[model samples]
Target: MTRLWNDPADFADEMIDGFVAANTRSVQRVPGGVIRRDAVPEGQVAVVIGGGSGHYPAFGGLVGPGLAHGAAMGNLFASPSAQQIHAVAAAAHAGGGVFFSYGNYAGDVLNFDAAQDRLRREGIDCATVVVTDDVASAPADQASLRRGIAGDLIVFRIAAAAAEAGAPLAEVARVAARANARTRSLGVAFTGCTLPGAAAPLFTVPERRMAVGLGIHGEPGIDETDIPSADALAEQLVARLLAEIPDGASAAGGRVVPVLNGLGSLKYEEMFVVYRRIARALEEAGIDIVDPHVGEYCTSFDMAGVSLTLFWLDDELAALWDTPVDTPAYRRGAITRLTDAARNASGDGRATASAASVDSTPDADDASRRVARTVLRAVQEMSRTIDTHVDELGRMDAVAGDGDHGIGMQRGAHAALRAAAEAVDAGAGAATTLAQAADAWSDRAGGTSGALWGVILAAIAAELGDTGTPDAAAVARGVHGAAEGVVAYGKAEIGDKTMVDALVPFAYALTEGTATRPLADAWIAAAATAGAAASATADLLPRRGRARTHGAHSLGTPDPGAHSLALIVTAVGSVLAAPEEES
Candidate 1:
């Protein structure tokens, strides 16, 4: 359980601030996250790694001399936004290029790929090596679909070591890919973790039971069983990993880096005891153990669990693994230090400022100003509505997925409202206001829902434009565009039991109703239809994303994403109707 937090919404921000302050000798504050204040060798590839914030010593704590050059930290259990990743990569890039690494998750893949594309467009050489090492998440044939857990350390170290040795970007990325391919991990949880301000854990294992194959982001496990002793757990983990040796590798007589990792709140003694038995078992099986790590490399907030990662070592990988590392958490042998004094003297640690652009507010037409006001009103209503339903939404999401949907929506909606208000105050038009809000929502929330909503808002904003008030037909087109954008971006169909389920029907109803009816009346009707569609998800088996792992356990519960979208659209409909009644 999280005991100390000023405001749940501000936890990530505050945590970063304190982390930077304490580890100033190792890392410096940057726009997206922390970058090593220490200078990199000239023309060396910058190893920029990150994901969600909860996994300490992974995304951020690894940023130092021989690990990650920079980390783009996101909100708890959420992937960093594309803009955030871009900011960190741009700040961290040396003369050579930028190499990106992170866990294999949908949000991380989507956001990191976007950042990589953007960097390439700007003529910055950026390469990505996604870590997929949790064997329990997928079978050997579907190994690419696994999630990276504690095994992230193995892949990250290989890339950073290659970079430190002055390898080119391509070679460094190749080294990382090799490590990711060879690594395998399996995790089990004795208890679920509670997020700050939450009433309960994301999911729970019954008394004397354990959840096996759980994810690092509070995602419930794929299976459950009665809790076992330390030696028994270690044997099970070792057996599971040994069964699937990397392609062209033999489990027996293999040189391996076995990392026994504690998922937060698990003690060092527990990990040590477990690792002892694990090491003895490996030796008996004729496998030679290389450098073994036993501690927290990755964490899931305060989840009471542990994971074992086996990184099968080749000659090249063994050399990379022996390289020195110095970070906020992990440290190794001596390396050249780039003191902060020298960094400050050279002005290398400060964020480079960009030239200001010309203001676009003056281009807004008078009619568009009125429409922008309405958009602001609806945004305010959405903020209020999300606040009211945050707890309920979390409860619904806890039925299968990680139970942060409500809190995520609250953060996004509030941030969106603030951004929209600022745009409106600046005399911006409808498109600009909505676009600004969209960016804020995605950045502040930092999850799959946040990214999808950002796409949906941006699609609508494109049709809103700046010159004049958009008509019913134009607005309907925007709604339809939002539906299309969400489906395309999230890759979730209507029957997949996601927000797209409600969005498609709402857009169709709005377009059909607007053929003759007023915008307000049509919106209200469409919103009602969306609400019903959201409720109907209770009967559909989830076929996409995280909920799919939980399967039948998610049945009888409305999809949280669809429910939240329905709530927001319904609130906005009322806001739209208010203006009509006043007129």
Candidate 2:
């Protein structure tokens, strides 16, 4: 369990600060994350890698000489926002290009892709290689759908090695892709991890039982069985991975890099014992083990579990794998010391300041300002509602997914509320206020819910311009737009057991009701519809997100996303029904 923290919300940022302070010789703090302290050669592709925080020696700790040039560390168990990713990439860019790589989680993919697009638009050539190597998450035929776990270390290393060798961004990306394709991982858990400030573990295995095929985000495993001895466990993992060797890779005579990764709390001695059996098992299968790693590469905070990753190495990959690495946490081979003069050649490793823009907001009309105040009130109510139901929501999510949904929603709502209040105090219009709130929510929360809420609010803000008070029809259009925008951005359908199940029906009902009823009445009806739809999601299986990995474990539970959406919309409806105060 997580025992130390000033505040749960500030944990990630505070941890990064301490990490950079301790490793000042190797890394320097940037706005979004950390970058190398030393200089880079001109026209060398910068290899930037990252994901949610809490995974030590990965993401941030890997930022140094032969590893990642920079890491865009996000909130614990949440992907970095597009803005955060872009900032790290921009700071890391050394005139050649930027190569990005990370675990293939949904939020990570969305945010990283957005950052890649933005960098390209700014004429900074960028490429990405998403690591999808957890064979337990998906079948062989659907390997692309697998979540990246410990296998991502192999991809990050190969990509960074190619970059250090002065390969172009395209070449770096190609090698990273090849590495990901050849990597296979399977994880099991003896227990679960607790997030900072959480009262208990996210999920737990019964006494004497072991969870197989668990994710790194504190998600419960897909299957459970009686705990086995070290040798038996090693055999099970080796056999599973050996059975699903990547296409074109033969087990016999295959040169593989076997990484025995401890999730978090597992002791080094325990992992070494497990790896001993793993090594014997691989040798018996006629495989040549090269640089076998036995330690924590990626981890779920304090999870008493381990994962095995086999990176089938071709000639090119084998050579790349042999490259020297000297990160804060991971070091390999001998590295020549860089002189202080050479290390400071890049001049503090900070990105150049861009031209400043005007920071003033245009004063809104009387009607729009009044509407903005009402928007602030609605956001306030939503925040309060989330705070009230946060624990319940976390419990629902813990049934099949990582139990951070409640806290994530709470962070986003409170962040949005703060932004909305600030905008209202500045006499901003409804559109500008809501837009600012959306950005804050997304940036602060840094998760799937955060991104979707940003999309939803921004879409509505677009319909509610700064000029006048929006009528019922206009509000309905805004709600409809938000629904469509969420669908497009999240790529979740009505029956996917996500928030879409509630959002779509609510949008439709609001659109229909507003045609004949007042805005408050229409919203009330829509909120009720959303509540029912959210409840009905219990009957559906999750077809998307991390919960899908657990399958039947979530059968009787309502999706936390769906339930939170319903709660917020219902709270907003009550605000709409309240009597208007004087402007």
Candidate 3:
């Protein structure tokens, strides 16, 4: 039972503010996150690390000399928006390039990739290395699918060290990938973590039992068993990590760096007790131990858990690991601190983009503007529907995926509704109105669903031109276009137990129904098909994304993305069904 927080929604922001204030000598607050107080070299490749806010010391604390140049802080347990990522990357960029690194969660992947794309378009070089070092998330053969955990420290350290040593962007990225490949981590949780202001834990372990392979964001473990003694727990952790040695790491002479990490509430003495056995286990196996770490490096709010990470080292990596580092949390070999005059000479290297904001009001015809108002109403109705069902959606996701879908949908829908009303005020047509809404939703949501929704709206808006009032056929074409675009972009088939399952049927139903029925009637009929398809997903197992590894656990629950889509589409259909005179 964790306590002490202001408004739950504002927790991440408040935490970041205080973090920067306390570490003013190490970091300065940038627009999206914190950056090193002193600027980087003219040609130094900037390494930017990021993740959700709860994992302190991991993201923000590591931003200083010999580590990350900046950290993109997102909402608690949520990935940063693409806009936020881009802003930080731009601010941290030096003459060489910018390198992005983070855990390989679905939301982080989507948003980071999008930001990388955006950066490239603006002529700033950017590359990404996703850390997938959690042994519990996937089988050894499928290591790419594993989620990153406490092992992020290894990857981020190596990457930043590579950059600090005058390595180019490619070298920095390569070293990061190598570190990720050689790293492996497994964790056990005595209890699940409750999000701020949430009534209950995201997932729970039974009394006298422990959950193995739990995620940082309170995602339930893949396996559960009776709790073990500290010695037995160390054995379990060591054996699991050693079982899957990376290529060329099986030799007795290979060096290894062991990190015993405590999630929020665990005591330091408890960690030392566990590390005692861990050290013996490694020594018995003839693996040379490097700078062994035992403390909280990454945390999951208030969860009582710990993870063991082993980073198999090569000569180059071994040398790099010993480099001096001075930061808010961790420190290594003594390094000369910048003089006050020198530090004051270098200011925060921030880059701002000037956005064009012009009133396009009066350009849209009266009829189109009226329809925009109707779309705004529909957006509001969809938001209300999502607000009513947030808890249910979250429950569906906690079964397998990180349990943040409900909160994510609520954020996206609210942002979209606000953007839609503003677009209406700007005298935007159906196309421009929806385009603005989609951008806002994706920007605020910052997840797989948000990414998908953004693409869907972009495709739909392309079909509905601003010049003409979009008729039933035009809207139907947009619907089908959206379906094709989503499938093409997300690469999920109908049977994959994603939102595609509902979307494909709804797309077909809308096209067929609109051929003869009124627009509102067709929308209602299509929404019904989506709703039924969403319900039917309870019988199907997830075959994509994070839930794929925990399929059995999620078997009885419908895909939350699909279910939320059904609810929103149905709600929006009702708004469309009302008499035109109502608008």
Clashes of each: 0, 0, 0
Q: Evaluated with TM-score, which candidate comes out highest?
A: 2
Give candidate 2's error at residue 549 in angstroms. Answer: 0.9
Considering TM-score, which of the candidate structures 1 and 2 is the better prediction for this target?
A: 2
Model 3: residues >4 Å from true position, as ranges? 347-362, 580-583
* Model 2: lDDT of residue 59: 80
Instruction: Give the alpha carbon lDDT tens digit for every residue of 186-303 in model 2.
Output: 9999999999999999998998999999999988887899999999999999999999888889988999999999999999998888899999999999999998899999999999
Better of 1 and 3 by TM-score: 1
Off by over 4 Å in 1: 340-362, 580-583
Which of the numbered candidates is closest to the native, going by highest lDDT? Answer: 2
Query: Each candidate's TM vs. the true structure?
Result: 0.96, 0.97, 0.95
Candidate 1, residues 1-583: lDDT per residue as tens digits?
8899998888888999999899988887787788887877679999999888878877889998889999999888888888788888888888789999999887788788888988999999989998999887777888777788998889999999999999999999999999999999999999999888777889888989999999998888999999989899989999998888898688678999999999999999999999999999889888999988899999988899999999999999999988999898998787878665777676564454231243566469878888999899989999999999999999998888888889888888999999999999998999999998998898788778888889888889889988788888888998999999888877789899899989999999999999999999999999999999999999999877777767887899999999999999999998988864463
Q: How many angstroms is residue 327 displaced in model 1 relative to the true structure, after the best TM-score fit?
A: 0.4
**Better model by lDDT, 1 or 2?**
2
* Residue-by-residue lDDT tens digits, candidate 3, 280-389: 99999998888999999999988999999999999888988987888998888886777768765765335233223444543567777777777788888988998999
RMSD of 2: 1.7
lDDT of 1 at 194: 88
